[model samples]
Target: MRALRYYEEQGLLASARSGSGQRLYADTAVNRVRLIQQLYGAGLSSKTIAELLPCVDAKVSTPESRERLLVERDRINAQIAELILARDRLNDIIDATSKPNPTCDYV
Candidate 1:
């Protein structure tokens, strides 16, 4: 609960309090926090995730909102492309290094 409160304060979660002062997290809030955790796990910084939240929460039925989500999807695709390229390059490097060193070997 403490951590949840801290997260709410950090603009990462939204919690509403009742007249009696009981903090209640909307059902959507639970999913939102989980989404944040997922994004964080994907290597995005907290600040970047925060910036992307508006688009994430936008209604998919709206054209503008749908476009925003598509934009973010494209960005993710680009990152995946770069990672793939880097992995291939790394594999090539390793393959080259693993080849027989023509002039150098111990007896």
Candidate 2:
């Protein structure tokens, strides 16, 4: 809970405290934070993530916003997939380069 408060102060989360100082969050806030983390993990700029949040929260023009979010998700997914492929290729190269030379002619 204290960590959550810190996150709020950092603007990674948003909430309001009650009279007793218990924090209350907007229903969508956790989702927003998850989105922020996802974007960060995908190598997106915090500024870009900041800029996109409001439009996403607006939930306006139904189909338009939905499509936009889908596009973002797809872009992130593609980046992840490309990274995985690159990793596999790197492993293959490493394995091939590290193969033991069985020929004792050089010994």
Candidate 3:
């Protein structure tokens, strides 16, 4: 699929070309794709994901890589906090608007 090709182009995936020039994926490709999707869903950019993938593949984390992941985690936490505040503000507005106007004759 196009997404798979894009992932390949981004260096997040690999594929072998058949004699007919069609792409071939190993059995492990499924797991790799799933991990890529998970990282993306967690708000990682392609560049960040590419940097992290090598560490993940090696099953070893250098101090620098650990620091980078920690920074990303902090960013995600901050975003979650902001979204929660925005949701609360929206709820407050909804509660206020749902109240009847005491001076309205139509009421």
Top candidate when judged by TM-score against the true structure: 3
- For each candidate, the alpha-carbon lDDT, in order, equals 0.75, 0.72, 0.94
User: Model 3, range 1-107, lDDT digits (tens) per residue?
Assistant: 99899999999999999999999999999999999998899889999999999999999999999999999899989999999999999999879878787886763
Tens digits of per-residue lDDT, candidate 2, 1-107, equal 67566556556678887999888889987777777777777766666555566676675545655676678789988988998999999999879868677873554
What is the descending lDDT order? 3, 1, 2
TM-scores of all candidate predictions against the true structure: 0.56, 0.53, 0.79
Candidate 2 C-alpha error for residue 85, in Å = 4.3
Q: Can you tell me which runs of candidate 2 are displaced by over 4 Å?
A: 1-12, 60-82, 94-107
Q: List per-candidate RMSD values in Å.
A: 5.4, 5.7, 3.8
* Backbone Cα, N, C clashes tallied per candidate: 0, 0, 0
lDDT of 1 by residue, 9-50 (tens): 767788778999999888887788778788777666667666
Give the Cα RMSD of candidate 2: 5.7
For model 1, what is the alpha-carbon lDDT of residue 76?
Answer: 83
Off-target runs (Cα >4 Å) in candidate 1 are 1-7, 10-12, 16-30, 40-59, 99-107
1 or 2: which has the higher TM-score? 1
For candidate 2, list the clashing residue pairs, or say none.
none
Candidate 2: global Cα-lDDT?
Answer: 0.72
- Candidate 3 global lDDT: 0.94
Residue 63, model 3, lDDT: 96
Q: After superposition, how far is residue 60 of candidate 1 from its true place, in Å?
A: 3.9
